[model samples]
Target: MTKPQKAIIIGAGPAGLAAALRLQQYNHISSVVYEIRPKPTTLGGAIGIPSNGLRLLHRLGLYDNIRLRAAETSNLVLHAIKGDVIGKADLTSWSRDKTGFGYLRIQRTSLMDVFYDAARLADIPIHFGKRLVGIVENSDGVTATFDDNTSDTADFLLGCDGIHSAVRKLYVDPNMTPEYSGVVNIFSLLETIMLPQARLSLDGLNATLTTDGLLALCPCTATNEMIYWFFSRQLSMPPGGGGRDGWEEKGKQEVENLKVTLLELLKDTSGEWGDMWKAIINQTNVVKFYPIFRMVLGGQWARGRCLILGDAAHAMQPHASQGVSMALEDVFLLSKLLEIPGRSLEEVYAVYEQKRRPRTDRMSKMAERNGNVRKKTGPWQLWLQECAISGMMSVYNLCRLDRLGIGQKELAYDVEEEEV
Candidate 1:
């Protein structure tokens, strides 16, 4: 097999940045990250990097760098919207023992800054405002045509371009897309006085579910007085279906139509949760509505000399908060496989898809199922959750599902083995 000299990474988000950094370190792989979003530094949202993710950050020498900029969350508290203490679990103890670290709650922009700075330190060039227009791959390599009509070629092209990936469309089939889970994630961050009723420690996070839907309140690691809430409800799927491919083309009016519809669903919770809902809604901050959808992959994640990573391959619901973590996992696994001794690109890609696809697929299914159990109107389900909560001391413990593969042997590049 030929040595990996150059590669092209689409999207400068966490996954792409991690891949570029690791590949550069091990394979001395020169790369360029093409991102359509300009001013990537300004992108902001609350993102929780679990202990598993923290371990990877440590490997890249950015763990402490991120720790200084982010808040460490001990648990995810679960409560009844009606003000009843339901289930709680101590996530810090469970995961800390397993991975030697805890969860870090940081803004999306903050996390990106850490990754981007590390890439810069490693001298990885990131090309912003470059939209991919076309992709042509042959037996030897792949070429990417950008919206500016400029083109670049490399040994392989990695598509980390999120759910709506042009590279996926060009190399893979056009029909495979992320479908709506009948949910709209309405989230906002705002300054608020630390009220006594707020169950989350000014330092912790909460996942409160009612007969209405799910409301998650978590403190911002960057700001103590501010809190982030992700409010969502299940919606009925439209006829003929809605998905990532057809989502943007659905038009503002159609999307707006759905937003108004989701707003109406929140009506049931309006008169129930004190003025908490009012305070959140009336705050002088920006609120954004995102359509929640899960991607169902068709065929495989790689084709010929092209491969897709992150949301491009498997866009899962955010229930388990594993979206970015799984993407990080891809960085670890794929990069290690590529560094293998005498392995062809095709063989490495095949191994990566085989190892990762099942895990991500299982996680996606869990998110969908959990969404159903979290619906507020379900009496039996709520009762079951409440019973489980009582058996635990913290909200984190109550909501702890089967601890998945955390101690899986870390996949690292073995230079001695590869060289021999």
Candidate 2:
């Protein structure tokens, strides 16, 4: 078989777009992206791009643009519910000379803008309002059919769609479904002024650990203290919740109701000074509830020139905060594998899976552990958690181990320079 060139990329997300760009840049593979939404995703309020993700973005010539739009967060400050500082992972001396980046926080919309603009500048075509419904693969090529009843043929197809991937459902793993992790995250963006009048510094990524759960506030925009606040709580999906985020009018109303419920639930945390946590929630006009989901990712990543990447391949919890970084790692490694001369899609898929799956599996376990530690707990467990966080942060800071979020052993793996 000839080397696969023309590619069909499903989902214009960070992984998909980055895959397309990398494929074009390194392997000279041309691609067309199909996204279900009319425009970029508003999935969450903001995200933190670690060094691993940033390095890949830099290789794609997209680093500068994203850097300009995001805020640099050097400290992950841990705090108790009563507003006492416990510890912090100072990323200042995190060996920037090695990883070439620290931690960056940016709004989801801004990051999407960078990707979309970059795709446009690179002359890649992204077809919006197209939902994939069917896929057919033959010796000659693979064809992707959308809900519109139209189809496009390519040398191969990639399911960069998402966790709930149509490519995975229709073509790859038809019987599989996203398993609810019994954890839900409530998140929103806010101005610094919106916070209750408290003598607290908003310079670092502030994480408040309550007896119930965890709440985090990170500076997002580069110029100001526009905070991207999110909290984790144990909540069940209503047999089939998470239909969508609170975007539409009906969904917005549902979030508003959840907001009121959350206020009641967190009433115990209110103090004589004021309900600081409740005030932040009450002032937030746009609140979103996202239930964490995970996919069992032990099987094949490809079948007959069709493969999956990013969340479509392995969806984990958010405690690790490495979702986008891992997705970018997937994009980087896959494209690098494809660059090997005269390699068929099958060989490329094999090599890609061999090198990628173990890493993702390890990450999945790490995320689970992180989530468990951050869960709501009793006083003894909470005290243990506080000690654990402080101790770990102290270690990280003393060794300047923040060489990247997670450091040299993981974040330092630069696939661009590694042998493919």
Q: What do the candidate models score in CA lDDT, each in turn? A: 0.70, 0.78
The best candidate by TM-score is 2
Error of 1 at 317 (Å): 0.5
Q: What is the lDDT of residue 79 in candidate 1?
A: 59
Q: How many backbone clashes does candidate 1 have?
A: 12
Put down candidate 1 lDDT per residue, 1-420, tens digits, no spaces.
888789999998887898899888867889989998875863356887776678778877889888887766766556564544455555555557667877777778778888988988888989899989888878778899998988899998899888878878877656687676777676777665734444233346766665556777676665455677776766555445754445444434444564444345444443324345545555525666677777985556787777888888998888766777778778878777887789888898888877787777877887787677545466567656667656644433344442432222222211122221
**Per-residue lDDT of candidate 2, residues 247-362 (tens digit):** 24433454767666556545545352235566677778877867688887575678888999989998888776678888898888887777677778888888888888888888
Candidate 1: 10-residue stretch with minimal lDDT:
411-420
For candidate 1, give the lDDT of residue 352.
83
Provide the lDDT at 9 for model 2: 97
